[model samples]
Target: MPTGVALHDVRGQLFDAAERVLVREGPSALTSRAVTLEAGCAKGVLHRHFADFDDFLAELVRDRVARIDGHAAALRESAGTGTVTDNLTRVLPDLFDPVAVAVVSLVTSRDGLRARLREARPVGVPILTDAATAIASYLTAERELGRIAEDADVGTLAPTLIGAAHMLFADRQGVPPEAEDIGKVVNAVIAGVR
Candidate 1:
């Protein structure tokens, strides 16, 4: 935010500001006014774009979910090209970033926001489900190429992997897990499956 700076992609600006606040100050710092001040927009701009603070938060979480989902989808291209651990290590931790964890916590704490999210979907945030599906899809493709063991239970393992990753990320608080740490987790998971 600055003097006389034109607002472009105000939605993205607000979301980015919201993320910075959530990461730097924690979930309690998230508020319409806080986001507007951080984004350098009119105090009312956030309210103007969404029905309420909860709605704004839902959208923010949705945006992050979509971006991470897209990353998982792209993992298909790396199928059979790398070890399963390598491919998963490259992406699973991306799902558990501090901003993402804070957004999820923010949404879950507010019943109204969580309800709106459920109304928009079927259950909890789809980040994990999306990742699981993406991982399963990649595994299936690899199986076809004889990369994965035919006996591997991808259907069961994919979700288990995602859940483990979720725990790993949730435990991080604000500190980001290093790629090596992710590699270790992925290695442990893959060792069980392979």
Candidate 2:
């Protein structure tokens, strides 16, 4: 193992490596050694940056979660412009990207990682829960605009959409569902409220 190699943005490199490992090999293959190897760095480098493997995994999850905040903002912003179904259909692919799906699996499979994440994310499964919240907020904005039914329950609808979408995208051997297929799902879920 090479020591003292100058690697810029080590944390980002390791995280990106971890995501690649997760997406390609699934959670069982994720380890400190795997991450460092994928990053092409000395194993000690990972320890130098993170307290431990679980800590690194937790940070990786938090990093992904922060992305949802940005997506949520953009989804909320598109509340009144496009068709309700179109707005939602566009966001699902992003929210359920290969890395995000693999992260959800990693978090669920690792007891330590899940416990560590509870400090920052006390409720809901890390990425999926946040995605649901984003959907709920977008639906709420639509309801306010009279695009969604006034009586529609955004709370229930949000999770329902997330669960439905998750099933469609989960464990697909890398091939994503067609946009038209996803649009049909979005339409079916929100049809009652539209």
Candidate 3:
């Protein structure tokens, strides 16, 4: 007798394949046929798993955002032991690293993929903003404890700092900061709080 698999199992495999294709070939290469082929299934397999390519791409963005949010949560949970700057230094590199840059570039470029990203915006924005807020909150706490300048505008500063990290990682101009260099930049930004 032949073995059988559940529908959800097959659907998960299709999504997994779509992720690999998006990560490896960028958004332009993602198509129903491509994803089905990558998943080692019939052409209709992708449609059965997803209503269409747009649906697949939407799920992809959601999945990536969730992963990033989870990482941010882990960092936030461990942030108590270190200085605000120290915790940020430890976390930003992983969040805005080269692989993440590549993923962002792909998602933001294709129209269908971009629409999916927009659909996921409600979830993604809060995840990203929460990470920024966590950093800002840490800064605010440090200020209260007298470790940082009392008048510092952490609300504005945190997003600026995160934006800078994003730029550095996405710097296609080939002048992106090294990890140590990013540390220096972050430290300088935090130090200028006064």
Highest lDDT model number: 2
- Regions more than 4 Å wrong, model 1: 1-6, 171-174
Cα RMSD, each candidate: 2.4, 1.0, 4.1
TM-score of each: 0.87, 0.97, 0.73
TM-score order of candidates, top first:
2, 1, 3
Using TM-score as the measure, name the better of candidate 2 and candidate 3.
2
Candidate 1 lDDT over 109-181, as tens digits, reads 6777778888878764556666788888888877787777887788887888888777778852546677898
Query: Would you list the C-alpha lDDT of every candidate in the order shown?
Result: 0.78, 0.93, 0.67
Clashing pairs in 1: none
75: Cα error in model 3, Å: 2.2
Better of 1 and 3 by lDDT: 1
Instruction: Using TM-score, give the best candidate's number.
Output: 2
lDDT of 2: 0.93
Model with the higher lDDT, candidate 2 or 3: 2
Write one digit per residue (lDDT tens) for candidate 3, span 139-167.
67667767677788888888888777776
